[model samples]
Target: MTIAGAQIVHEKLEAAVKLLEVHNVDTWLILTREGYDPSLPFVIDIETQDTTAILINKSGSHQAIVSKEDYETFKQTEVFSDVITYDTYMDEVFLKVFHILNPKKLALNISLYDHLYDGLSLGLYHWLERLIGSNKLREIEVTSEPILKQLRCVKSKAEIEVVKKAISHTTDIFEEVFGKMEIGMTEKEIGQLFVDRMKMRGVTNGLGKPYDLPLVCIVRCGLAHRNPGDHIVVPGDIVIIDFSLRCKGYVSDIARTCYFLKEGEFEPPEDVQKAFDAVVDAITQSIEALRPGKKGYEVDAVGRACIEAHGYPTIKHSVGHQVGRATHDGGTILGPRKTPPRPQVEGLIQSGEIYAIEPTIIQDCGLPCILVEENVLVTDEGPEVLSKRQLDLITTPYKGVK
Candidate 1:
C-alpha cells in the first residue's frame, strides 16, 4: 500500500495549507528532535537524528532545516520544496528561512490541551525561544493544535480504503473463531486461535514487537482475564470479545459479544439480550446524532443517555475517538469528560473524519458487560457506518460435552 508514502505526505501538506488559512495563521512550524513528536510523520519520511524544523507557509511554500547527515534523505522524499542542512547549529538556516518567508504569525506544535499536538519537548520549546529571538517569537507563536488536528483527523480517499481493509480483515478473523470455538477452550487457547487466524490472513503485527493476541474474551462474570487455574468456556456463559489490528498503516478497532447456549437452545438468555439491545441502541442513536458541525459532548451525551435509559450503567470513558494512524489518534472526541472538555472536544465534527463509537454497559444482572465498538465516518449527509454492524446477539450452540 506504500503506507505513509510521498503521496499521503503531499496530500496532507496541501490540506495543511487550507487548514492554516482557516485558522488565519501564516506559518506552520514543526520542530522535532529524535522523533519525539508524532506530527513528524506527516511532514517527513526520513528519520532525523538532530533537531529538524519544517516551515510550511500558508502561501504554499515548504522549507525544511535538517541535520547535514539527513539532508539527502529528507530531500529524496520529494515532498519539501527546499531542504536546508546544518552541521554545527540550525540557528543560521532557521533564521535564513524565516527572514525570507517574513510571516507575521507562526503556528508551533505546543498545546497544553491535546496530547497529539503536544509533540514538542520542553527543551526544544525553550531552545526555539532562545533561537528565534524573544520578540519575533512572541509576535508569531501560536499553538498548531487546531490546524494540525483537523489535517490529521480528516481522512482522504486513499486512507479510507486502507482503513476498510483493516476492518475487513479483523472481521474475517472473528468469523473463523466463531465457527471453531468450543466450550472447553481456555481463554489462552481462544486467544491463540485468534492469533493463528490473523496470521493465516497475511496480517501480522506491524509494531516493533512480535505479534500479540487482541482478544478480550472474558468468560467469568465481570472477570476480564482467565486465572492461572484455567477457567474454561461453559454453556450459558456470555463471552465478549474484542479484536483489532493494523493492516498496512491504518488500524481497525472493533468488538462483539456472543452467548454459549446448551443443546437445542436457539437464543441468548433474556437478561443478556436486553443488555445487548441497550448497547446496540446506544450505537444507533449516537450515529444518528452524528453530523457535521455538532460538538463531541453533544454526540456523547446522546449515547450515554440511551445506555442509562435502558436501565444500564453508563460507560465511564468517552463514547468514542477519532481512529487513524494510532488507535486513539487525537482529533475530535465523541463525548466530554468530567475534567472539562477541551477545544479539541468542543470542535465541530467535519466530514471525512473517522471515529470509533464504543459504548459499553456493565450489567449487574448476572450478564457480562456488553461493549460494542464500531467504526464510522462523518459525511456531509450524516454518519456512514464503516464496519458491518452487529445487529443480533451471536448464539453459539453448546454440546455440553465438557
Candidate 2:
C-alpha cells in the first residue's frame, strides 16, 4: 500500500490547482538552491542538494526540473507529474519550459512581507531574470505568498496523522525524561536528556522557530526552564519543557510544565496552580473562539483577554501561529486585537488551518514564565485541539538530596 504521505501530496497538488485558478496565476515557480525554500517541504518531498525549479499551473500541471544528479531523487518523490533533468545548461532547460507554458502571470516564491513566501535568493532571482530576459520577466507576479500560505495552512487528514505521530513521541519522551529529573540535576542536563531521548528515538532535530538554524533546535528548550545552564533545578522552581521535533517531514511543537516539589509536598503550590489555571483558561477561550472567517487578531484577543482577566500582564508574543512543515509556519498569526497593519495578522482565519495556541505569562506570581501551548485545527464547526492539553501542572515528587 502506498503510504499516507502520497495521498497528502496528491491533495496538496489538487489544492494548488484551485489556488492558482482563484488567484489567476498561470504558473507558480519555486526556485531554490540547497533546499532553502520554505515551501519545498509542502511541494517537493525529497531533499535536493543542487538547484531545483518546480513549476505548477492551474491546469493540474506539476513539473520538477532539477540537476541530473538530483533528478532521480526528485522523481522518487512522485509528487510532481513531470520530472526533467539538466546537466551543465540549466538555464536552457528552464527557458524551454518558460517558452512552452508562456505564463502571462508567473508567480515566484518571493515576498517582501512574509518569509514564508520569500525563499527566492538574490542569486536565483538574477539567474531567473537572465534566463527569461527583462521583458518577459515583467509577467512574474510575485503573488505566491497567499497561494502557498493557504495551501500549507489547511491540514489534510494524512498530514494531521503525521503530526499526531510526532506529538505522541513528544508526549512519551516528556514522561520518560521528567520521571528521571532530580533536584540536583542542572537545567542543561534536563535539556540534554530531552535531546538524547529524541535522538534515541531517531529524531534528528527539534524546531524552536519552525525553520530554525541547523543545531539550534537541540537547545531551544527554554520554554519551561531558562536557557540551559549549570543552575540546579531547585525545589520551588517550576520547569517548563517547550520543545518540538520534526518527524517524517512533518513537525511537532509541544510544551509541558512541571513543578519541583518540596519535602512531603503532594501537589504544586497554590499560586502556581492558579497561574496554570489562568493559562489553561486563556487557551480554552482562544480555542473556543476559533472558526472559519474569524480574523487572526480577534481570536488572539480571546486568549489575551482571558489572561489579563486573571490579573496577569498581557502576553508579549502572539497567542498562536500556524504550524506545519516549519515551526513558526508564517501566514495567519493569532496576534493582538489592536494589531498594527500587517498582512497575516489582519487576514481571516480559514477552516482546515492548524494553529498553535500558546498563551504565556511572564513573571507570574514570582514564576519566571507560565506557559501552555496546544495545537489546534480550525474546523467549520470549531477549533479541534490536536495535542493533548496539559490540564494540571505536572507535580514532581521530591527526590532526596544528592
Candidate 3:
C-alpha cells in the first residue's frame, strides 16, 4: 500500500477499535478465505489464499494468522501486533489465540439485515463452531452488525476526501457529456462519452462493468438501471442518465435528466418540465430533512410527500440510501415506514454519513420519468450538498437535419 493507503487503513483500524469499545464488544473476529468477507478490504487491503483469521480486541491488541505464503504480506503492513504463520492448519493457532484473549463477548460477522456485515459464510461459521466447540461458540458469539454499521456508515476524514473527489470527477464527466449531446445521438453513443472520460482519468464505474456502468434511458421506453441500447435520441426526447464511478475504493452515484428541444423551442414540453420540477422539489425537501438524529423513514417521508403533493404517483424505491464503499453501502435506507418498521429504515441518520437522495417521479400521462439524485453529507446543522444540484432540466437544442 502507498503512504496514503496505509494511512487510511490505520485510521479505519483506530476507528474500529473505538467502535468495539462503544458496542461493548470484547473481541471482534473476521474469518476469510479467498477474499469472501466484504469488510476485509476496509480493515485490511490484503487477500489471503488460505483460511485466515483477523482478531481485534477492545484492549487495543490486534493479531492475524495467515498461511505461510501470506505471512510476509500481512507482516509487511506493520498494523498487526502479532502476525502468525502456520504451515497446514490455522485452527490450532486460532484456538490458542481465542484462549489467550478469553473474550467474554466475541463478535462475528453475521447479520440478516445488512449484507455488508453478513460476510461470515455458513461454511466458515460451521468451521468456527466445530473448531471452538458448539457450546463455547454459543456462549461467546454475538453478531457484529452494530459495530459494522457504525464502522461503515460513519466516514473518516480520509474516506470523505476520496468520496468527494469521486463525486467531483463523476459530475465533471456529466457536464462534459451533456454539453456535447445532440439530437441524433443514440443512447449507447451518449453512454460512450462517459466511458471515454473515465478512461482518460483512469477511473472506473462504481458498480458493474464499464459498458453497463451508466443507465442511459431515453425515458419513454427505457427502464431504470438498464443498460443503454441503440435507441436513438430524437426531438422532444427526455434522457435520464444514472451514473456512478469508483475512485480509490470509494464510489459516487448521481443522475441527471436532459431534454432534446424541438426546433424553435427553448424549453422542454409542459409535461416534462412539470415532472422535472416535481423531482427537484422532492430532492430539495428530502435534503432539508437529512440531518443528524433523524430516522431514515422520516427523511424519506419528506420527499415522498413532496412528490405526491405535486400530483405524481408514489415513488417506487426508497428516497435515498447511504453511499460509501458500495453504491448501496448497506446501512440506513430512507424508505417508507412499515407495520413493524424495517431495521434499515428505522436506523437513525448520524453525522459523517453520506447519502444519495434520489426520489423518482413517474408522470401520469406519457411523459418521461424524472429522477434527480444528489449526494449529501449529514452534519449537525443539516445536509451539505456534495454534488452540484440540478435545479432545472438540462436542454439540448435541436439542430435541423442537413
Candidate 4:
C-alpha cells in the first residue's frame, strides 16, 4: 500500500474502534473470499483471492488471517497488528482468534436498512454460522449498520478532496457542453457532448450508464430520470441537465437549467424565471438547515416549505441524500417525515458529511420542471457549498433561422 492508502486505513481503524465502543460491540468480523465485502476497501483497501478473516476489537486491536499468497500484502498495510497466513483451510486459525478474543458481542456486515453495510452473502453467513456453531453465532451476531452509518457518511480529509475534484470536473464539463449547445441539437447529442468530455478527462459517470447520463430534459416533453432521447432543443425551450461524475471512487451529482432564447428575446419568459427563482430559493433554505444534530427530515421540511410558499406542490423525491463512494451513499435521507418514517430520515446530520441537496419544481402546464442541485459539506460552523451555485438560469441564443 502507498503511504496515503496506509494513512487512510489507520484513520478508519481508529474511527472503527470508537464506533465499536459506541455500539457496545466487543468485536467486528469481516469475512470474504473471491468476492470481497463491499466495506473491505474502507478497512484494508485490498482484496484477497482466498478466504480471509478480519477482526477488529473495541480495545483498539485488529488482526487479519489470509492465504499465504495474500499474507505479505496484508502485512504491508500496517493497520493490522497480526497478519496470520494459512496454507489451505483457515478454520483452525479463524476459530483460534475467536477463542482468544472471546467477544461477548460480535458485529457482522449485515444490515436491514443500508445495502452498503450488508456485504456478507447468505452462503458466507451460513458458513460462519457453521464455523462458530449456531448457538454461539446467534448469541453474538449483530448488525454493523450503526457503525457503518457513520463510518461511510463521515468524510475524511482525503475523501473530501477527491469529491471536490469530481465536482469541479463535472461543473467544467457542464460549462463546455452548455456553451456548445445549439438549437435543433437532439437531447442525445447534447448528452454525448458530456460523455465525450468525460472520456477526454478519463472520468466515468457517477451514477448511471455513460450514454444515459446528463439526463437532458427539454421543456414541454422531456421528463426527469428518463434517459436522454431524440428530443431536439428548440427556441423558447427550457432544458434541464442532471449530471454527475466519479473520481477515484468518490462521486458528485448536480443539475442545472438552461433557456434557449427565441428570436427577439434576451431572457426567459416571465413564468420560467419565476419557477427558476422559486427552485433556487428552496435549495437555499435547505442548505441553511444543514447543521449538525438536525434530523434529515427537518432539513427536508425547510426546503419543502419554500416550494409551497411559492405556490408549488411538494417535490416527489427527497430534498437530498448523502453523496460519497456511491452517488447515493446511504446514511441519512433528507426526505418527508411520514407516519412510519424511515429510519434513514431520522438520522442526525453530522459534521464532515457531504450531501447533494436538490429541490425540484415540476410544472403542470407542460413547462419544463426546475431542478437545481448543489453539493454541500456540513461543518460545525455552518453548511459549506462545494459546487458553484447556479444563481441564474443559463440563457443561450437560438441558432436556427427564424
Candidate 5:
C-alpha cells in the first residue's frame, strides 16, 4: 500500500497547532484563490480548485471551504474531513466560519518580509479585508510563514517516490543524449534533443503533470553556466548540461559535465577527474550530515569549505536548497556564504523530505565545471540518492556514430 502524504501534512498541521498554542494563537487560516499573474505556480495545485479556503483550529477539526462545483473533487483528496460548498459569494460563509470558531488569533499567509511565504496578492488581500466588514483581524495575525517553510522543506516517503521516478527518467534521457552527441551540434539543438527524447520515453504523458520539462535545459561548452556561447563543440571543450523537471509537483535538478573526446584522448583529464570527485565528495559529506537537527547556513558552510579546500571557485549560489514543487525548492542555503541564517536546515533534513545537492566547481579558465547534482530522501538512518552513479565524466566515445 502506498503511503499518502496527506498524513504527513496533517501531522505537520498538528505540530503547527502546538506551535501556535505556545504563542496563544487559536486558529490558522489558509486562503487560496486563483492567483493573479503568478510569479510561480503553487505547490499545492491538486488540493484546491480556482478558489479554496481552509480553516484549521486547535482542536484539529478543519473544513476545506470551496465552491460548490469542486466539492466532490475536494472530498476525494481526504485532507479535510468536511467539504463545505458555497453558492455565489464567500462573504457570509467567511464571517460565519470565523465567528463560530472565534479564534483569539487567526493565522493568515501574508508575509511581506519573506518572499517565499508571501503568496497572498494585493487584490486578494483587499478582498479578504472586505469580508472583514469594518472589523480589523489584525489581532488575528498572519503567521504560518515558519510552518509553511518547515513543512515544505521536509519531504515524505510518497514525495520521495515521485521525485525518484522523475529523476530516473532524467537519468535515462541524459544517458541517451550522451550516446547521441554530435560535435557540430548547437546548444539549442542538443538541449532540445533531451526534451524531444523525454517525450519519446513517456516523461510527461507517462508521468501525468505536464511541466515545460525544464524551461531552461542548458547544454553549454567551454565557459559553462556563464554566457554559454552558441559555439560549435570542439575537441577539449567540456560540455555541461543542467536539466530539471517538475513532476506531479515535485521538482528534480541534475547537471552533467562531459568532455569532448578526440580520436585518441578517451577519459577526462586526471585533474578534471579530481575536480569531479571533489564535487561528489562535497555532496557526499553534506548528505551524511543531513538530519532533523542541523542549522541551514551551517550545512551550507560545510559544502563551501569542501569546495574551497580543493582550490575550486566558490559557487556563487548556496551549496544546496529545498526541493519540492519548484526547482530551487526553498529558501536558505547549505553554502558557506548564505546571507540570512535560515536555521531550518536540521528541520529540513527530517524524514520524508527530498532535497538535491548539486555542487558545480569550475576546474580552470575555459574549462567546464564538474557539475554534480542528485536528489536524495532524508531518512531516519541517512539520505537516499534518487539519481544514480553520475560520478565519472561521460565522454562521447566517437562522433556521428549514433
Candidate 6:
C-alpha cells in the first residue's frame, strides 16, 4: 500500500512475466517517463519505482530503466535484472536496451482495436518513435490491448479477495440507502449518501478508502432520469437507481429501481416486475451457460434472447464486462454486436476472471422502470452472483423500506 507500491507491482509484473512465458509473448514493455502522462497512474498497479520504462520477456528476464532520482527506489525491489537509471530522456536508454535484447517483436502500449490500446497517448507514441528512431524499433506492435487485457482480465486469488470485499461493502450500502430513499428524495442526495456510507465504512486495515467511489450513482425517477443523466428525483415517482462502485481498486455495480409508493396506493406494476423478472431469468440462464471454453457471445446471446423473447427491447449495453481495477476490465463482452466475434470476447471466460453481467431493461409504461442490474463473476465451472441474489421487487413503502 506504499505509494512506492512499486514493489507490490513488481510482484504483479513477475506474475505477468510468468503468464507471458506461458502464452508465448516474447516481450511486454511498459514505456513511460513522467508517470503522470502515462495511461496508467504514477503509482500504477503494475508496480516498480520511479518514472521508469519496464520490459518483461518470455525468457524470464526483467529490466527497468528508471529516472536517476528514482535509482534507489527501483533498487528497493531488486526484482529486475537490469535497473538502468537515466536523467534526460529514456530515448537512448530504450535503444540501448532493445539492442541488447534484440527481440523479434517489440510490443508497445497502443491499441486501435481495444479501448485500452489508446492508453499510450498519441504524443507519447510520437516521442517513443523519435527516441527509438522509428525503424530500429521494428516489430513495435500495439500489443497493449492483448497483453493488458489478459494480465488484468484474468483475476488472481488476491484480486478476487479485494473484489469480494468491494461487493460486500457496496451491497451493504445499497441496503442502507434503500431504506433512506423517499418519494421526494433528490438523486444527488442518494448519491452523496453512498459516498458518506463508504467513508463511514472506512478503510480495511487502515488501508484508506480503497478508491471506493460510487463512480456512477443513478437516480432515475418517473421517466426523466431513466437513462444515465443528471436528472432529479421527485415526489410521487417511480425511481430507478443504477450504480457502479469501486472498492480497494475493485469495482461492484448494481441497478435496482426504487418506486415511491404508499402501502396500498397502487398494486405493483405487473409489466415492470415482469421486465425485472425477465432480466433475472436471463442473467440466471446466461450465467448457467457460462463456463470455460465457451465463447462470450454465446452467453451474451442468452440474456439478449431472454428479454427480447418477452417482447421488450434488448438492452443497448453489453450483457456483461470483464471486471477488475477499472469497472470495464478488458476481455469479452457478453453482448457482442460484431459478427465473427472480436478477439476480446472471443475466448472462453477464463477461470480466474471476474465479470459483471448487468443486463438492464425498461418496461413500457407511463412511468419508466429500469428492470434489473446486478453483479456476478466468472468461475472455474460457471458464474457466481456477487450480491445478495435480488429476486423479488424491492418494495419501498411509505417509509422507504428496502
Candidate 3 to truth, TM: 0.97
lDDT of 1 by residue, 1-402 (tens): 144456677788888889888988999988888777888867765568888898888889889899888888888887778999988888888888988998888898888867888988888878878987778789888999878887789987767887888888877887888898778777777767778876777776422333676555554645343322345778877777766678766788888888889777788767788988989999999999889999998899999999999887777778888888777888778876456547657777889988998888865646557877899999998899999898888878877767
Question: Per-residue CA lDDT of candidate 5, range 140-255, in tens?
Answer: 66666766665555555565667787787888888888887777766766766777876785655222235233322233334434433455776665677777765565567777
lDDT per residue for candidate 4 within 198-315, as digits (tens), equals 9999899987665455788886875668878888878988888888898776789999999999988988899899999999999999999999999999999999999989988888
Q: Supply every candidate's count of residue pairs whose N, Cα or C atoms clash at under 3 angstroms.
A: 0, 2, 0, 0, 8, 5
Tell me the TM-score of model 1.
0.90
Whole-model Cα lDDT of every candidate shown, in order: 0.80, 0.79, 0.89, 0.88, 0.65, 0.64
Q: Give the worst 10-residue stretch by lDDT in candidate 6.
A: 204-213
Candidate 6 residues 1-402, lDDT tens each? 443344436546666777666656677777664553233531244444455677778786678788787777666666677789878767787779978887666667777676654456567667777776678655555365556666667766666777787778877887998887665455666666777787688732112244333322232324333323345444435556555666655666666665556656564567556766777888788778778777888888888888789777777777887766666766676766587657766667777777777666754445344545666767775677777767766766665433
Q: For this target, which candidate reaches the highest lDDT against the unseen true structure? A: 3
Pick the winner on TM-score between candidates 1 and 3. Answer: 3
Range of the 10 consecutive residues with the lowest summed lDDT in candidate 3: 362-371
lDDT of 4 at 243: 88
The best candidate by TM-score is: 3
lDDT of 2 by residue, 33-82 (tens): 98998887677666788998999888787888899899787777776778
What global local distance difference test value does model 3 have?
0.89
TM-score of each: 0.90, 0.90, 0.97, 0.95, 0.83, 0.83
